[model samples]
Target: MKAILAAVLGLALALPAAAGVTIDAFKTDSGLTVWHVEETSIPFVALELRFKGGASLDAEGKRGAVNLMTALIEEGAGSLDARAFAKARDGLAASFSYSVSDDTLSVSARFLSENRAEALALLRESLTAPRFDQDAVDRVRAQVVSGIRSDEKDPNAMARQAFDLRVYGAHPYGSDKSGTLDSVTALTREDILAAFRSTVARDRLYISVVGDISRQELGPVLDTLLADLPETGAPLPPVAAPAFDGQTVVIPFETPQSVAMFGQPGIPFDHPDYFAAYLLNVVLGGGGFESRLMQEVREKRGLTYGVYSYLVGKDGADVWLGSVQSANNRIHEAMEVIKAEWARMQTEGVTEKELKDAKLYLTGAYPLRFDGNGPIADILVGMQIEDMGTDYIATRNDRVNAVTLEQINRVARDYLKPEQLSFTVVGQPKGL
Candidate 1:
């Protein structure tokens, strides 16, 4: 059945994309809002569920409780033990993945229309009746601990942690979501349960379903699948303040190359000039080899192999950030080049050609995101999370194209701060 589903998705991808996408939005009897795209061509359904409060909902000292609970969700449920749960899920050839980041917990599911009931029943059990048996908790906790230990020695991880620590201070975003070794070791089963209950309630849930489901079928489906969840989860954390000081901080690590994470403040998604900022980022550092940072730092000076930047507008905060790794000896030069480029953009902004190319690439690439049901479902959920309307799909390209060069340049001058760009370098290098 999985193979058949895969083949069906492949065929769907091969067909030409429709010019416009029609999304139907409705709420279930239980007041669960769901966005749906009914693609009848395939006998498969791709469903995505997003809960707003993610690892950030960890209770006091139980830092990684939410992450650990998410990992244990699929380990067992109701009457099914870990191995039994796997066997049953495989029997139906359904797929389910549960993941949590700092601000969101996501469940992605794929199943044939015929197996919908079984898949959703199994899914419900996982959500509302997770066993969190001692052995499964211990096993998954060990895996998470192992990963935490591994990250402690990783240079890139060092840079990220260092950067987060400086920017977020006491905010939950400052600490790693996976928790410290001691915190994970001390987490009790009750802690995991608390995390689960606090994170999985209905008020925080956003769902999107694509393929093989209709408005009528979806209402009962959502009610039956999700109505069991509590009415509300724990309150979300307070808004974070990202303090990006214009300073270069170094962590001494033994590595051939130094990894640098650099960033400053950024605009929110709903901000009116976000498209201009988005286009500006594409020209400045985000557009692969064509980006100004990549061209200057890699192609021109051969200072690094690759460099890129992006906007991260997390629910609590927003920032413009980028990374690059270079040999310890060349890292200083790379840092200087990146800073110069940052300042250059602020002073001169992007050329008309650069802005045009960014608009063209972004607009042209937007439609390709709908190639498969799963991707489309994921996109739909993300759009909803960003509070975008259903017409966003149809109007997105036009918005991208409408970003004038003057607007991007103005955003560049207003938002980019060379002096405020913080660089956290992780490696032992000769120079500053």
Candidate 2:
């Protein structure tokens, strides 16, 4: 399904905009913000709720507690057993999903409008009074441990772990969300409860609703669903700026190809030059084959089959990062070419043609993401999380369009740091 969406988005790059999605913003008395759009074509509602201090709030020695608790929140809640909860949800033809990432615990609910009340009741239980049954905790913990065991041998995972450890040091961001095998195995029920209390709270909530629902109907539902949470999250782990000092660390693996993850500090989401940096990223490395890194490493030198880069702008940290996989003997050539392109773009900004092409694709393809209720709801919550304005959906492409070539160049020089790039390579490579 995601591949199909990617294909449609590719087509959207050439096509002009459809009418922009009309998103309405509201707030409940409990201080929870809601972004809504009435897409009644489908008789279903998609709800997304985000709580801050997600996996990052895991207590000492309980690294994966938040993740484990999120997975079990819906497995059993209130008085319902895991089987009972699933049966109840399935009876209503509703779906509930919970996930925890480095920054947030995200809950997604989808249900037919006729079942809204029942579905919401289930969601409320999961949020406000999750049972965290010992049986469910044991099951979920085992699953996360299984995943950790799998990641231990995966080269890409190894490279990513090395990269984060090098960049963020001992910060929470550097910790794996699923945690280490020993950590997951040692997690206690009390730790899970503590993590749940600390992470799912009213002060950090962001909510969005889309599809067959009205503001009047949703207002009370919002308060009922969220009013029971704690007012504030536990103190988040301290913020630490990324410290990349251009060192290459190689993890030896018996493989034909070396996977390299390179990164440096990047501009934050709230920076005035963010949109410019976003546009600049496209020309520098985010444009796939059209990006300079791809042209230099793959099309020009044939050192790698593919290469790409992107910007990661979190609440307190940012990174300009990229990855490439190439034969062990050719990895050095690929790295040199990637570094050269990174340095070159800073010295000589992208061409006008490049700028126009990027703007055309970025602005034209922006609306394709709103083609479904779930995606739109997700995007709405994201807008609030990023502190963008209510009319941001309407004005976003204009912001992308407003970035001039000179501005791109200036931000490029200010932001890009080829010399500070740190590389973490997995596999036996010829050179570093």
Candidate 3:
């Protein structure tokens, strides 16, 4: 009886560990990667398509062209106007959305299996046959231009933009993903069409479908939707790291609060130290309320409501940034505290307790990312785009768990030099 009770207790703890999700991976005939996860609890399905060339592919003067093209895709395509295209999805009770980032453009749709055919047809039209009508272009351009003007008045936006420029210089990632007002206005319909043809090629595409779908069922659907796209394997240009000219830029604004942004060049996604840097960032600032930055800058001194830092990993370059907003009078003091924390992380390194807790939170919380098919499919697509291996899901926690205190200390010293960093303040500072 004693032996049986012990066996049962051991099995109970092992159950949660064994209950993790499994994502099956495969590829299409045309070389597009596919990741699938099936859930029988509901009759819903989601398909996501990601293209390699995103905002980073924009031409020198055409900063916002990729974003504009993404917005215009659904405006008119394949025997449907913008309203008709929307009504088609609404009539089927399906959800469709498109988004652009520095590295990729994603189009996703979620709907019942019964409506997958019609929903996918609409997606195909949006991808291959966008009309780029004048009305839609003008409307979205106005909105974007208005947004640029709005950012001019926003101190936080100003600070972030200034920081990127200071760190990245002439690199594409250094520029705002959204083009400036002048560049956006200069973009013609021809430019949008040309960008689409060049960037959205089938060869540069990866598709992931999850929830109540199999490879056999999805293969023909994908073929039909993407059949018309050209197979031009236009390779992306190599993105070189931009030189960081360490300087402090102060943008004078009259707001009661000041937004402080400090930055330096960091690691790209494919770097060997990527995981180590990611772990270090969480301990430093990415852990939110549990992070040292928040503990020292906010909780300890009450300098601001929140202070945090992150690495913006891009296709060519990455940026390490720390930002906060506080009273105008407290801006300089807040900077001092942030600088102190950065310098300390570089010199003294993290405690065993700090490193242990960071690993615990990072590793233990990994399962939350795969709670459903939608998020799992999203991660799979992103992994494929970043050239991460399929086993990345299975091995991710182990990688985080393997980061040693020595590794953290080395990365902290190498990447977190406060004196070599650039500073941007977008409100009235006490001294300036």
Candidate 4:
């Protein structure tokens, strides 16, 4: 056991030094793009399938259909029932996870090299031939409804829902990924089937594989896994026009502490100044204790225990959002401090010292993310989805390092809007 532990630690230490890891990328005859990183240290593989137009493809009045369909894909498929499918996966010692966010429905699996063929076959069934059985659909729908009912009383959930509704208005992004109780309860087995057929297709698929797999071997596997999916998915809705009027909307939840979620339109990931704005955001709120918001709101004034902000560049819209929680009486004070800091950042930008520290932390911490095969596969697929080039892994740190104080200040002024920032406070707070 000691020897095995030492070998694992040794491998972990050695992995960070392998900076020359190259991704082998190719397009299949069916037009699916697959990225591979051959890590031969373990006899295993981590695979991901990202289908675009996730929840955004839901038809009107059937808001949660796509989400429900995604959750049910692995419930059963073809000849296998839910119990049988679970048993088969356990027998092979493989894992499969199915989920959907606003923009993508992702299926991920990991398996030993010896069972690669079996694992891949199981995954193909889940994606291509999901049963969406009536019993299973009812069961999962009940689960979803339960979750929605719980979220109704959750202050944090209430704040997020209120914030998105205000910011995105009638757009699909305004709604929670899990549909409302009424919408979800209305979903039927046929709705799930239509959603599955419309969502899983080749035109918008993204693939990434890591571990003991060779390019020559992965080609046929890719073809087989995706062979049954349609050529194109239902077209996604147009890009959402996120409407933020900068009003401070308050939801009256009975809690001693109030939670505030705030943000406005943010720069897209593809924007030229994205990295600069990203670094600026780190100084503003993305960085934890070292960030300006943490310093002003918690460290100096003692208003709250934590506060943070981050960039949200979804496929349909981009945003900069943050959250904080404080006593109902002091929540308004917290908002004041946040607004002051927001304005101060646009005016003064980050100091040279702040910029240096942010760059050092950002650049140094990046390589740690590539330590394992599964994480590496995720990052590779994410880079491609964001349209970051194949060579991004090698050049990412360089880009972070290249952001000058001038660039950051320019982006700060352009992106930060104190007056246009909207706040959604959940809880009955005095002095709002």
The TM-score obtained by model 4 is 0.96
Q: Write the per-residue lDDT of candidate 4 for residues 1-432, one digit (tens) a residue.
A: 234434443453356432846899997776678999888876778898898888988888998999999889989988999989989887877778988988999988877778889989998888888888899999999999999999999999999998888888878888998888999999888888888878888888899998888988888889988898899889887898887677798999999999999998899987889999999999999888999999999999999999999999899999999999999999999999999999999998999999999999898888888876667788888888998988998888889999999999999888898888899999998899
Of candidates 3 and 2, the better by TM-score: 2
lDDT of each residue in 70-106, candidate 2, tens digit only = 8889888899999999999878777789998899999
Ranking by TM-score: 1, 4, 2, 3
For all candidates, the clash counts are: 0, 0, 0, 0
lDDT of each: 0.91, 0.85, 0.79, 0.87
User: Each prediction's TM-score against the native?
Assistant: 0.98, 0.94, 0.91, 0.96
Candidate 4 or 3, higher lDDT: 4
lDDT of 2 at 230: 86
lDDT of 3 by residue, 104-198 (tens): 88888777666778778888888888888899899988988989999999998888788777666777767788889889999999989877887
Clashing pairs in 2: none
**Highest-lDDT candidate:** 1
Candidate 1's displacement at residue 373, Å, is: 0.7
Which pairs of residues collide in model 4?
Answer: none
